[model samples]
Target chain A: MTGPGQMLRRPLNPYLAALVSAVVLIGTLALAIEQRAAILRDGREILLKTEPVDPRDLMRGDYVRLGYTDLSSIDETLVTGPWPDRDTTIPVWLTLAPGEDGAFVARSASFSRPETVAAEEVVLKSLPVRVTVAQPSGGLNAIGRLEFGIERYYVPEGEGLEIEKAQNQGRTTVAVRISPDGAPQIARLMIDGETLYEEPLY
Target chain B: MLRRYLSRELDQWTRSGLLAPGQAQVLLADHDRRYTGFSLSAVLAVLAAVLFGAAVIALIAANWEVIPRATRVIALLILLMAGLAAAAVAVRRGAPWVAEAALVFTLLCYGAGIALVAQMYHLSGDETGFMLTWAVGALVVSFAFASAMAAAGAGLLGFGYLLAVQDLFSGSGTNPQDLSSYATVLALAFAVGVAAWRSRSAIAGHLSALLLISWVMWVIFETTELEPGYVLAALGAVAFGAGSFTPSPLTGTISRHGAVSAYGAVMLLSGLGLIQVSLVDPGLGVEMALAAFILVVSVAVLAVAGGENRLVRRFAYFAFACETLYVVGETLGSLLGSFGFLFLGGVALAVMAFAVTKIEKRFKKGEARP
Candidate 1:
């Protein structure tokens, strides 16, 4: 008995097969490069103070795990949107403003992107956080933990320890580029307010 | 291996007057001529491709700073194009095995390209996203070449995505309401199945089925209202019925190269075992009733498909023996001392073994009649 796949089988030209596969392969890589470059090209810059935890990834090699001080824990009173009933990850938009130490801190957060923003303040989108508990009045009892896409800074092999040491000394900061849509790209790494590694726009 | 075994057996049969003298040589030659597609060179080519791809991935993971990032990217692109060109040449020359190896190599290079791009930019995307992207690329390659190897790769990557997103290994419960996440996985699994069908690759088909089963297990892990044991048992019964009792043509198609009945029997027995585990300490009447039901199911499975399937027969014997010991231990262990329980358990297993041997003899006789 012939199956459906057997019925549909027809010989394709080898050159055409190769061409189609190559297009998919190259197109995926090109799209990834262009997306990252666009964010770095026309995005607002913000300096964030972070603490680093070291972990090794098999695919991306050794890296410094960055935890933002101001954005990691936001007060429940600052949240201005309805919270989900169940524990599930949802995207959050945070408005950042300069604090006393000249580093950006989250001033207000919302489930949806805010339309209006002050000139001095920048809105950055968090990846998602599992909201554990919610209040009856459309607020969260606990916002759980939040992360931006700029959480991990990949370093060369055996060089993560140097950044980890600097972070331990409270001297490490990250420069992030925020696109108009609240997406952020890591632009540079700094120690003691001095630029350590600047990202290329490739 | 089959050819050599046939040769030895034919020579003995000829000597014993079971066959004519020249028949062995003719049969051996025919077998050799009919099965010439598999070649050692093709296997070696695929192995070499895999080794080369792994080396490229390791180079990317090393974050090698000696060469500039853009230069490395360009080199990878060149290698990918070269692989595709090789595949085209092989296909044009009608060397299908070489074409398949080349396609596999190109897919691996594409995955390495994703990892390299992510590392170059320090993109903090989760592993699930990375695996999904790689899997999508593999699916495209599979469709383009109708390559079984690429389809199998996609199946594996889809399984990896499920593991990354769900707490399968960690045992941490995921939210049951996250059906949308599982929907994406189901779609990937379906694509893999279609790819396997297009390639007519039995290995890919098995992998696709296993992926779907893993997805079902993930769902079972998340939801608590339905008991997993019962669900597995019910599904297994349906699968077994479809494989063993379906009218011809469909039954022949499903069981042609794989034993669906064996897998079904396994799931059924596992479910029964879980039900036993959940018993904890039930009333004597309930315990006896559950034990009787398990024994009956084992015997029924043996009676249904045990003659034709060796795996099912073995599972039946195993379940029967285990249940005998459990009943003996539960009923007689307390009344008798530890030594007495061990003696009785040994005796019970010995009796079950004897019965199984008799059953095997009957099955052999039944087969011999045909």
Candidate 2:
């Protein structure tokens, strides 16, 4: 090993540099794989209700923008506790319960995790989203919006339009695998209880 | 090119009995033995490596769903290991270009693997997250290998990360006034600039400079009510003044060059011109004043650094020429006035050309005296 200045003066050992490069590449791949495998193996399964909007990502290709009914459009009615009235990069926990159609819906949402949980209730977590309360209506029941990271369902190219069309007819549902840590992964896209696409955990 | 010119001069010197034939041959040999540029084989080897890397990425993006997830991961691991092993052998064989290119392929595989895993696992991340990961990986590789190509990649990825951050942070439905994300971009630009400087890659350094300047302008626009064009003009003026007139404390800490002065002069002139265009009501008086200031600055920069700094000279010439055309476009209200200005401009240019020729002769005579 050399001093940082001396390292710049002379060329690095190619073998060592190459070895470090290989370790980083393999390490990233392994970490991603292990993370996904944990979710797929030990995570609980739940059915999330979603409506689709057409969108495209340049790198990941086309996707049916998954607009979760419970998470995408959180209102004052769903929130059980005091909502944050300023900009925050904090996760809000939503306790989930089975709705009329046996699909999971938000029973109570809070900026902090609820201490008590019912026997049949599950909790889903959101990624860090900025929550801002409008100035005039900064009250307990202020109608504020929430954004969750589990918003997009990437599909193969040219398959988004069909999903959106089916979603328009109220025939689409998302099967999500919630990790033990409350992180949700989109597992499958179901149209009329038939599996359209099942995601592979790499 | 330098070697050829010097070799010819040495031949003439030898013929004129300024040096012996042995000394001329020795000088030519010394010059020829020095490693000045990459060989054709080295260039082609790097090109081949880049093409192969692109192919690997495309193969992964094809998303062979039929393959088991474990199998795809294993395959990528194997490819990554193989690339490193081959690079190691290339290093031993003294093929530095091949070694560097293999490292590039390894880095590309790392990115493709990350994207593939995200796609397979249905991970909820945006382009910003993806770009940050890729850029950090490239930067680490750049540092480890001291690779110029990797440094360039890191610089480009840093820019992509900045753009993605802007897109992701702004339209997140909440916190529309969150300008704090710019701090992350500033930090990224500084790191990439350091990597570029460490690699001694001029192209990456230029890209990083552009990134830093753009970030400054963005911060000025977001935080203050000042017009960015005017602020940029003032910034460029300060940078040029500092680099040219003041002794840089960075002379011992880092390399110093006259290029900073040239870069600053270009930015100052361009920013000033842009500010004029951004003016809402630039009246005739203001327009004429602006025109005069631009002309004076252009000439002053040309006279100050025109001999040593080619970039400054070129930008000054461009600004001067463009301002002259702009003045003609603005003052040409009547046909008679247009003809009169055209005649005046012609005479002025002729006199300027005579002065330039005289200066050129003086410079040549001064050089001949040495």
Q: Highest lDDT: which candidate?
A: 1
Model 1 B-chain TM: 0.82
Worst 10-residue lDDT window for candidate 1 chain A reads A52-61
Query: What is the per-residue lDDT of model 2 for residues B141-222, given as tens digits with 9 covering 90 to 100?
Result: 7777676777888888888987876654543433423445677678778877877877777877887888898888766665
lDDT of 2 by residue, A81-120 (tens): 7766554445678888889998998888887778888878
The superposed Cα distance between candidate 1 and the true structure at residue A113, in angstroms, equals 3.0
Per-residue alpha-carbon lDDT of model 1 for B250-330, expressed as tens digits?
864687213788878877887887888787679888888988999999999999889988989999889988888888888
Candidate 2 stretches with Cα past 4 Å from truth are A1-4, A55-65, A76-95, A107-165, A180-182, A196-201, B1-40, B171-183, B248-257, B333-370
What overall lDDT, based on C-alpha atoms, would model 1 receive against the true structure? Answer: 0.82
Docking category of candidate 2: acceptable
Q: Write the per-residue lDDT of candidate 1 for residues A19-121, one digit (tens) a residue.
A: 8988988999989988888888889999899865433422234777787877877787898867655556667799999998888999999878988899999
Q: How accurate locally is residue B46 in candidate 2, as Cα lDDT from 0 to 100?
A: 73
Winner by DockQ: 1
